[model samples]
Target: MNDVTSGPDTPPLTKALKETAHRLGADLVSVAPADRWSEPPSFDTSTVHVYPHSGYTPSELMPSTHSVVVVAVRHLDGVIDSTTTDTKTTAIQGNFGYVLLNRKLNDITFGLAHWLEEQGYRSVPLGSAGQSRYNHRADDDPDILSVGYGVFSLKRAAVLAGLGRKAKNGVVASPELGVRMRLGALLTVARLESGPLLEGDPCPPDCTICMKACPTRAISLGGRVSHLRCFTDVGRRGVRYEEIKAKFKAQYPVDLPDVDYVDKEYWGNEGTGNRMCKIACVAFCPLGKRRLPDVMRRVKEFEQQRPKVELLSFPPSHEFALDAVGEGNSAAEPSGSG
Candidate 1:
């Protein structure tokens, strides 16, 4: 049986579930059979490359997993249309407002999981790399932590669930929202009928506009992206972002002048290096209305001036695969060290 199907009918429960997701603020919702994680269609390596999986399936999180309920929420207009350096720490990285969108999508995931549980089905809410506790004997491994674990690839799950086409810029581009969407999922024991993959690719053939627009040169052909360079561009390479922010808040006295424009040495007295990138990937996408024409033009111009340095993928992903599941590894073993 195919993991994704083009069935002419949606099952009754699946139909009601879609309505519930929308009512709870999900802009898009679809299902992929749990087994889809095990065998990607035609063994497409692109899906596995960016949203990689060393074979962690929904069943790792939910032993009885039957379907993965993928959900997405479009990014706010204020975030998508902001200037390259719109202040206030940008929320996403050094200069992006990604938190607002994440909160909404996570809420939808939480809501759907709760709804499924009420229906007597086991459900695990996968909001931004859901956690799974690991078995740890204090006698043998007293330092092992069971919390803050994250693994399930939400992007890969979105692709499997038929949310959007994985575009050249390395982001899934939905028909209505382009790449301006955040994703979350629910692993449920309920057997929801799956949706077929989106019908067509939004990216044009021979078009490498997004690749050219990237200042860090992170994205390559076929969606192979360098997570290291992408993270490094925003100064997310060696430091914990939340820790830096906390330090900034703890040290700065509100009465100080020009608090917002303090140099990295002042606010980030601990040598917190924070930089930003114009979201050229989304802004330059020739897709939906989310693409800001003026921003695209600026990005194109900046592309020519910026230095091009290629980057490689980081922290080999295989260690997180569920093959280690009953062998004592969490499906979410450990987040790759940035």
Candidate 2:
């Protein structure tokens, strides 16, 4: 009744059924007990204050409803890589890659929802914040109701469903996708078994590729991030920083002489605000390696490639958490203007 028992029919019933769903294009699928989803931490204001990415509003419908179904759609790393070489390509790919992947995830969620509904149970699909047009400038005041019933964020739902633990980068990485997968959820009142979260830092301790690769130094040694700095760097030119600046100033004449204008002007002249760091860091992680040493080697390769900043990206002792990069307890100045 609770867990799927392995009776003769059980093997055919559960394994065959789940495999068929995968054949229908579900990348990573899990059936979590509805109880596990009750009181998701995004609803906690304190937790939200600490982690701002959770959608602003809490859901009233799905939490009270039933069983939670979650799915992951693998993001195409090839397309993500194309963003680095060509700016036009980066813009085009970055914009569409996330969109396309999420759509696929939604489609899968809908497929699962309908499949569940056919079995005489009601179902709901988790909504996306990036898809919602509401102003999220106020991170604390998210429109939870607009996100609506049955839909859960890939970020929050993944951790709660026991798929994976949260990373310092604030992404959910699995042995399968690392941080490269997109998440979607389905809500149903049905009974199903859930998988256990993978243990330890799928990322190794010696691996600091993401940190060293960050252009803005947005990733902290302690696994903390300064989002504003990361965005500003991306917005301005971290990629073709100098090239972007020249193109922008040529396109527009500047008359104002304020700090904001100056900053804008500086960013315009130099192509300094692209997410090169994020691209580089993620592209180089050891997750895809055949062994931990391979990942560690990749991390070292990144460290060697990095230009020495005041603070270097170092590995955390524990697999799951991140610590700042330094010898003892010394802290570096926060990366950017948040």
Q: TM-score for each prediction?
A: 0.65, 0.60
lDDT per residue as tens, model 1, 1-338: 22222345348779989999999988888898877776435545543332445325788767888899988877666665553444434444323334445556667888888887777677888765532212223113323212111346677788778777778776788777878777788888777888876655567665666666565555655555643345445443433433432333343322224443323221111222334555657655667645555455455355554545433333332012222213211121222321
**What clash pairs does model 1 have?**
90-95, 90-96, 90-97
Which lDDT tens digits does candidate 2 get at residues 75-128?
565554454342333444445456565566666667776775665556676623
Best by lDDT: 1
| Candidate 2: residue 90 Cα off by (Å) | 1.0
- Candidate that scores best on TM-score: 1
Model 1 spans > 4 angstroms off: 1-10, 40-55, 85-96, 130-150, 199-201, 234-275, 289-291, 304-338
Model-by-model lDDT, in order? Answer: 0.58, 0.47
How many pairs of residues in model 1 come into backbone collision?
Answer: 3
Q: What are the candidates' C-alpha RMSDs? A: 14.2, 11.8
Instruction: State how far residue 204 of model 2 sits from its true place (Å).
Output: 1.8
